[model samples]
Target: MKKLILLLLTAILALGCTACAARPYTPAGEPTGNAALDEQVLALLQELCDPKADLVTNLGAVYDFLCTGITYRATLADTSGGFTDELTDSLALELLQKRKGNCDAQAALTAVLLRRMGCEAQIVQGTFLRADDPEPVDHAWVYAVVNGTDCWFDPLYGGHFAENPRDYFMADDSRMALTHQWDAAAD
Candidate 1:
């Protein structure tokens, strides 16, 4: 009985030590401000300058520009406090100014910029499953009509339909089951 008790205590101590030794997962990569990117976007928009510019083109340009300029940082905690579904335009602008926010912040900022540019854009609430994730995680992205087709954009992913081409977003109607649609009309 003494030997059995010793063995059990030893096992428990070993397990606890192992758990304590384990390190929390940290995502790699540093945040790149990409100043050149801002210049490029400004130039693009300037070229498309018109009293009434095309909505699709303007929105697409802004989305692509933002995605290229910003780097994904997973350090942001889930700050969706009291936000039932989406953030308001003012909140989105505040996040943009801060330059450090979660996926929802990126989506909100993109939507607001696109809207200001005279493009109809909206925030898409859904689940994004990483290749390793067996189940999807709650996520948010932006979608806007470009050239008569709905184009989905994710700044967190940081790609312009190329380089970081997303298999999920590429689908014609691919959307997560938990997707909640928020729009100006609903407000």
Candidate 2:
């Protein structure tokens, strides 16, 4: 009985240690605060408000607000590691603070702000065909159900919509294919 008790205690301790180690890190280089953060962001958005703030107009306003407010910089290997799979609002702030982020950060910030304004928004991972490239480049963007039609907005590309954003909504098709990996589905 004593041996069994000891084994159970050991297992519990091991599990506890694992859970502690697995805690997510707040993204580096961003200010993280509960009240202050919300206030700051809300104030910024309010400044750009239109009296007719419907989903389409509000989302466009927010997208333009972020794109214009935050300057874009390239991702650093050591800091952001080129891309962050966990693209939360805090992570977006971190990237914004550094003035650098990949497509993921841009999409994340856009998605979060849209959601706050009661828009149905989602982050989409996919490839984009740049002007010089025959092949599509790996990219992330926000898809919003705007006016009963799905529209894709790429904040990384100055908040432009893709040619056919609804193409991703085909049967058995997924937005995950646009990402380099399938793990973005978890976000």
Candidate 3:
């Protein structure tokens, strides 16, 4: 009887540790100082993400919103400038407002949302080769450190009209190298 009790206690301890490790996500990073922008992001999170789900599931929800909710367009704003802070901020806001953007805008918006969700994420400007295209084209995607593992999220290519968009979510370097080409040392 005492041995059975000890085993039960050990199992309870393990479960408790796991639950503690999966603490809820809190908003991180310096606020944009624009209340509207911050509010918009939070609203989107409320609509799209399940607060009780696992981290990867929540990330997938955001990716799904980007892939299906947002439309892809090479807007003048995307070509007019580089990824300056103002440009990135405007692009992210535009993506939420207009739901239209190119790869740059998609990546910028993804990074913004992920950062707001307290995930360490960044935009990666690189090249991508489609199976039908003759040459690789300039592209932008997201690189995130998720749960201490380096993961890649490409909404532009993986989400837009993809048969399996989830494949792009939380992908590692090896899996992303199938089409994405970027300087690993840069980010």
What is candidate 1's CA lDDT for residue 176?
25
Off by over 4 Å in 2: 1-36, 76-86, 95-99, 159-187
| Worst ten in a row by lDDT for model 3 | 22-31
Worst 10 residues of 2 by lDDT: 23-32
Off by over 4 Å in 3: 1-30, 78-82
- TM-score of structure candidate 3: 0.80
lDDT by candidate, in order shown:
0.52, 0.54, 0.81
Query: What would the per-residue lDDT of candidate 1 be over residues 40-73, giving only the tens digit for each residue?
Result: 3334445533324455444445555565555555
Angstrom error at residue 147, model 1 = 5.3
Candidate 1 TM-score, C-alpha based = 0.50
Regarding lDDT, does 2 or 3 come out ahead?
3
Against the true structure, whose lDDT is highest?
Answer: 3
Candidate 3: tens digits of C-alpha lDDT, residues 35-146: 7677788778878776678777888888988888887788667543457767777888888888998998898888888888778888888898877887988888899998
Which segments of model 1 are wrong by more than 4 Å?
A: 1-57, 73-86, 158-162, 165-171, 174-187
Task: List model 2 lDDT by residue over 103-137, tens digit each.
Answer: 67676676655655655667766566655667766
